[model samples]
Target: MGHADTLLAMGGAFLAAAFFARLGNRIGLPTIPLFTLAGMLLGPHTPGFVLVEDAHDFEMLSALGLVLLLFYLGLEFHLDDLKTGGRRLALAGGSYLLLNVGAGFGFGLALDWGIREALVLAGVLGISSSAIVTKILIDLGRLGRPETRLILGVIVVEDVFLALYLAALQPVIGGAHGVAEVLFQVTKAFAFLLVLAATARYGTRLIGRLIHVRDDELLVISFLGAAVLVAGVSELLGVADAIGAFMVGLILAQTPSAARIRRLVHPLRDAFAAIFFFAFGLAIDPGDFAAVLVPVAVAATLTLLMNVAAGLIVARLYGYGPGPAADIAATLLARGEFALILAAMAATAGLDERLAPFIAGYVLVLAVLGPVAAGRAHLVVRRLTGGRTPDGPDDLAPVEAPERTTSA
Candidate 1:
């Protein structure tokens, strides 16, 4: 499609999501599921609607959205919680990642897939839905609760892990000859990230003086330019585009105008992000689900169980009583854009050809369950802990648990 036609199409998609987000909210369903279902309708799997026949452009924009989303995530990444929750964040996220990888690898083994496929499944499952979890906490206005704090910290840790793994996944899955070649690629990625982190700390001034995103049109173009450039750079350097986009986000986060930048980028991001979702619906082969509903249902149930359990346990470790902990657990039970994005990454990395369908099915389930999870969390906490109780002022003490990694 030409630029103008593509722009119009994208605009129409965004409006559709916004329209549906409200409609979903009114009808007691989550906004994300509505958009997702709409996307499925537009996909080639269904007849007569085919808004997205190819997904290359859609993935490109979705990657851009995830990078920015994480950048905003980083803006909130204060390391002060490193004392207590930080350690728990690391431990929990790492343990979960390890467990997920092992389980996924085991599944791969059972399925007789390649090592690459195994790792990809583990990576996809190890990661949870940051977007859904955070929104649940925020919407309930409990983001500051000690239990919520712990859960958020763990979620942040997962994001970091996902980012790192995503960066390495492309090379590892690409058949890079041997360990040394893989190590070299990893080192380059490490070096690249270190440089970007350093730049995020100190480089905004130079970019600001040069880029001058003062005008709305200029701002939007520059925003897209940064995403495209960083993604292209990562591609050139044999790193994942997600890594480059994230680095760009981190750098942008440090800018004085980041909040404003995010505001300006939201409409653009939301538009593409919607197309990205629609593209996923389009990408699903009708047959992937036709004969596999039972397995898909079982997989989704397992995912929900594992993710919620992790959330609750982490909340307890952070000193929350059992009630709030369960709420924290239930609150984070859904997966959306980021998780699916990673699944799509697995497709690009050629890890497991089977991953996309599994993950797509997984996302469809989680999207429908997100708000329900939040509601159940609220109910469980009230029933168990007697409602709206906080972990109290004592948690202001040391954050180290000696057992799990925590974050902020």
Candidate 2:
């Protein structure tokens, strides 16, 4: 095919994905699963329209997409939100982490997984999809709500844990020589982070000054360049590049140029994220999934139950009424991009390919159901709270209309 034809193929794939995604949302289901399914339909395993055989590059591009995702997330975050959300951020986030990780780890051990695999799965379970949750909160215009704010605060906590986990994983997965060497590695890793932190604080300003007078094009390349530089530094330090990318995000997070940077980068993020989902779907062998339906269903069901329980228990402990607690819990039940990323990592690290499809199938089911569960949960809450509004139990009367959108 000619260059234009190849570009057309890429364009057509995304258009189909977007069309199905919107179609899914119109019918009241969240579009997360449909996007993946859309990718699958356009991939090699389908009857026709396979467009992603050149998938090796998508991995890095997808990683870039996630880097932007986290960057945007940090743009809206602060260490201070932990203080503002009351004790709920720490309490609820902490409780949710402990219960979910502990339970997931225990289950992995029971299934005879290695320590590394168990720990990895535990970490994955502990971390929620901040993207999906944040998307829902924004879609609903509930970003300023107490529950929403608390969720973001907890998500920051989760990101901290993710950084630590991803960093510590190298040695835990046997990439180090000894305790002293591991200690040295950890030190080097953190020392590298310090340099990046310094760049965040200092480099951005100089670069901002340099590009201050230019058009937004410079902003686009400069921001992506910073992320790549930090990510390269992380690789040299023998650590996960994600930590470095995340640190870059933290630094650019609250800058005067942050909004401008986000506006410049979001198109690329969305485009590459579509390819990310497509590559993810390519990794799934549906035949493999169908053959082991029983075990897969069991694992998926367990995942759903555990996630919902974790969210609810934390909400209740933080003093939310049962209805709001349940609503928050239900909203958090789906695992999206992060889960796929982790599964890909696990496969590379030699932890059971079967686990990926099982988890993927679960994600597909929950992505469709989670929003309905959350929406209906609001109705249930209104009834229980006796016509109280979601944002404030006494501020406004109950709204019977579809007054919210929770697409992620």
Candidate 1: misplaced stretches above 4 Å?
Answer: 1-12, 56-85, 92-102, 202-223, 378-408
What tens digits encode model 1's per-residue C-alpha lDDT throughout 1-408? 778867766776677667877887776665555676776666667787566666565765666655555544554443343455555567765655565556656665555567777777666556666666666666666655555555666666776677678777778876688899999987887778778767776777986665565687886677668866877788777777767876776666556666676677665555656656666655777577765566567666666667666655565555555566566556666767666767666666666556677777777787667667766665666666566655435635544322221111
Candidate lDDT values, in order: 0.64, 0.65
Candidate 2, residue 225: the lDDT equals 85
Encode model 2's per-residue lDDT on 247-363: one tens digit a residue: 776677546776676667667666766666766776666767785576546655666677667767766655556655765676676567666666766766667666777667867
What local lDDT score does residue 163 receive in model 1, on the 0 to 100 scale?
69
For model 2, give the 10-residue run with minimal summed lDDT.
398-407
**Model 2: how far residue 350 lies from native, Å:** 3.6
Candidate 2's C-alpha lDDT? Answer: 0.65
Give me the overall lDDT of model 1: 0.64
RMSD of 2: 4.8
